[model samples]
Every structure is written in C-alpha cells, then in structure tokens.
Target chain A: MPLSSRPVSRRTTLAAAPLLALAGCRWGPAEDGDEPAAEPSNAVPDEQQVKAALQAIADADAFVKDVSADHVGLAEPLAALTALHTAHQALIAKEGDTGTTVRMGTPTRATAALKAVRRRELGLQRTLTKLAGEVSSGELARTLAAMAAGVAQQVALLPETAKDADA
Target chain B: MTGTDALQTTLAAEHAAVWIYGVLGGQTSQSSQPALYDAVTTAYVTHRSRRDQLVRWVRDADEVPVAAEVAYELPNAARTPAELKAIGLQVEQRCAAAYADLVGRTTEDERAWGVNALVESAVRQLDFDGDPTDLPGIDA
Candidate 1:
C-alpha cells in the first residue's frame, strides 16, 4: 500500500521528506545532553497506545530480519532484531509466541539486521535524549516496566515520523 | 510487510479493491435508500482515489505495482442483498486485517497511513455488518 497515511505536522513533514538522503547517514546527539532527543517527560500515556505500539514494533522488526539477508552485512544483530520483531508482532496481535524462526541466507541475515538495528539504536539514542531519564506508563516505572515483556525483542527500525524520535 | 515486494503487493491489492468496490457500489442504484447507498458510494470513491494515489507512488518509486485480477474471488457467491453486504463486509475485513498486518511490518510513517486506511475500512465494514466495533484478527 502506498500507505497513504494522513499527512503529519509541518515540522515533521519537513524533516521526513528527505529520509532516503540519510539512509546511509549517521548522527550523534549533542554531547552534554542529547539536545535533539527530548528530555523524557514524566507524563503517562494511554495504556492502549503503549500496547498497540508494542505490538506494532513486533511486526516492524520482523520486516527487517525475515527476508533473505544473505547479501546483508551483519547477522547477529539482524537475527536478534528479527527475533524481537516477531515477538513484538505477536504481542501486538495479542498472541503467545514460540522461538524465532531462523531464515538461512547467502550473506547471513545477521549482518543486515545488525546494521538496521544499529540505525534504529542510534535513532532511539537521539530520540530518548529529549525524554526525562525516568518515566512510565500507568503505574509502571518506564516503557519496559509498563510492557513487562519476557522476550528480548529489539525495538522498531524506523521512527513513525522522524519527528517522533524513538517511537 | 516492509519488504519492497510485500508493500507493492499490498498496494496492488488496494488498487484493485478500490476499483471493484467502485463498480460494485455503483451498480446498485438504490437512490431511495439515500443514506445507505451514498455511504457505499463514498467508500468506493475514497478507495479508488487512494488506489490512484498508491499507483502513482509506486510508479514514482520505479516499483512494479500489482495488476488487477481478471476477476476477484469474492469471499463467497453473493447473490441476494444480504449476501452482497456479507461479501462486501468480508472483503473490507480482510482488507482491514491486511493493513493491520502491514502496521507491523513497515516503518512508522508507513504504518500511520495503514492505521487510517484500516479505520476507514473498518468503519465501512461496521456499516455493512451492523457492528462497527467488530473486526477480524490479524493473520500474524
């Protein structure tokens, strides 16, 4: 699907249009404090949003790791993210899961997945920069506590909008 | 779902679906039932517009879009009025679920569009099924 989602805010829309240019690019947050990343807020979000986002993250991660990755450069991170993606997808759909399926490839799915994961990691590193260090959803301490997930799943590779930061 | 192939396939499905809904919704000339009929018509147009938008996007990206099938395998043989609505509702549900599945596979930006489209389909399905809240499960 062209995914014709409704257009987002002007700020984010301006930032998102040039993503392909940054596909191979890298950036680091400001030193003393990650200025680009938000100072984590202490406010809580709707439980439903958290649950939905968690589930959505699962599926998104799968896309990164599932396909033939023989041509990719990193295997371990890819495999790990693939595992995490599947787990998140299952959780979003509200289903229990088994272990991740390992897809064999020429270059090894691991390398590409790792690079993808690193990109996501860097993205999040800058993103969480804005958030206050300590926060939580509902009565929990943080997203992890709110999620209370057992599976070690990697988060999403791309932000919904470059404007969303970590999400 | 985030794969180039998967996204292209989904875009193709939506293209055909929008066209089919257009013809199916339009063939019925129940103007007397204005509210109901108009709803169907609007859904068809909305989907069709979305289809065109998607096709253009695919072309712009130098991607091959899915071709329309000679004929769709309707969820079932919808003969009577009730059957037509049933089939229509089923198609919408499947479409909704398909998008929901994509919500997981693609980037955040991609998922936002999916969420909107899914909601639009779900609303139409609810109208057809008489229960706007009910939706099919994801194929995970």
Candidate 2:
C-alpha cells in the first residue's frame, strides 16, 4: 500500500472533531443572541467628577460649621453661605450618591476663616469649570458649569477682612 | 439651537450687562461714594470686554452679531447706592442665566467660555450683596 493512502488514526479523528467544533464557536452570535442590552437612559458617566463636586459641597458645609459669632461682620454672609451650601448639597446628591463624612479643616480666626472659605469656593469653581468642558453629557456639563458659577458668586460674597489671623 | 445662536444670545446678555453697568456707574459717580464708583467702573469695563469678545466670536462664526437694545428695563430708578447695587445684582443674575444656557447649548471650547462668563457674572452678583443660590442662572 502506498504511504499516502494510509487511514487516519481513530484518536486523531476524535481530537479533530473537537477542534473543528471550537473553531465553529468563534463565529457564533453574541451572548445576548440577536438582542442588544439596553443602556440606562440617565446613567451618570462620570461618577468620580460628581463625587468631587460633592466633596466641594461638603467642605463648604464644614467651613460654615467651623465659623463662630466672633467672626463679626461675617454673620450674614456666613449664614447665606450656609443656606447656599445646603442647597448645593441637595442638588449634587440628586445627581449621584454622596457620603456624609467630610474631612474638616481646623478652625481659624475670623478673617483667616473667611479667606480660606473664599479660596475653597474659588478652587471648586475652577475645578468644575474645567470638568464642564470635558464632561460628555450635555446635562452634566450644564449643571457643572452652573455650580461653578454659583461658587464664584459665593466667593465674591465672602466678607473682606483686613486683619490676618493665625490658623 | 446651534452654538452660534447660543453665542448670539450670550452676546445680547453681555450688551445688557454693559449698558446696565454704564447706567449704574453714572449713578454711582454722581453720588458721594467713590468706592462704589470705582467698583462700578471696573465692572463696566469687564462687561465691555465680555461683550466685545462675544461679538468677535459671533463674527468668527460668520454671523452678524445682534446689537444692544436701545434701553434695557431697569429694576427701578436706582437713585440710591443700595438700589444701584440691587439693580447690578439683577443684571448679573440675568447674564448668568444666559451664560448658563450657552454652556448647555455650545460644545467643547465654547462651552468652557460660557462657563467662565457664567462664573464672572455670578461673582459680580456677589459684589452687589446677592445671596448665593444652588444654581446661579437657574430660575427657582
């Protein structure tokens, strides 16, 4: 018998059957078959950015808590600040989940405290302004921009204290 | 609406802001309060720059920018310093709203521009003793 005419071994055929089956599986339909998964209509794409905004809101709240009556002329601004931060917290919480705990800055003298709060508001506004440009969702972009502007307004409202105090 | 339309809207608001600041500055300058006069002057210049920038943006988009209204409705006569400040704050609030809308309607770089404008106007409102709100531009 010619060498080329030899029959295939039984074990080899069995292995080849499984190999061909495995090759066939590569072209199979997706796990969902013909149907595609439905995307969440209002899912937040940037949860981290949203959390950062929440963190800013929490920091503002902490500053308000740290302030005392000794702050003098800042009483009304501080009170208004508190009201706005509360509203911001509510708005951010509506967008995504936020933790209640926040790292509190050490309390400082009146002037220093107002200045520190103003700096914090400015920082938040800057951050959100940048995020507003980058966020993919239109609604999220609008909200972030508006929040930044609101913080800017708060920064302007902060009392002007001429005297410097030690923190 | 397209980004150009939003920019035009923002340009209109800037026009109003600049005009209102001029009126406020005139009122403040006539009064004995130099400090208020200086503040209004600085704010007036800022609004003027903003209006000019918006005009440039509209021109770059190949659109004819809308002109400022002959007269904007004042919040009141604004004879006193307090009244002037109140009217200034109102102008800022309206400008903020317009910028916020632009932020929503524009894309990428233009959206960022809107964001800065919104922040500027909102902060200006604070100068006039306006209380902070959750959303500066958003109506309650």
lDDT of each: 0.41, 0.66
Q: What lDDT is reached at residue B68 by model 1?
A: 68
Assess candidate 1 and give its lDDT.
0.41
All candidates: TM-score = 0.44, 0.71
Interface RMSD of each: 15.5, 18.1
Q: Candidate 1 lDDT, tens digit per residue, A1-167?
A: 12222211111111111211101101100112111112238545444543444433433343454432443334343455455433333332333322232222222334444445455433432222112123232111122211221111133322232233212
- Model 1 / residue B12 / CA error / Å: 2.8
Runs off by more than 4 Å, candidate 2: A1-44, A63-79, A94-96, A100-114, A160-167
Cα distance off (Å), candidate 2, residue A107: 4.9
Regions more than 4 Å wrong, model 1:
A1-167, B75-79, B130-140
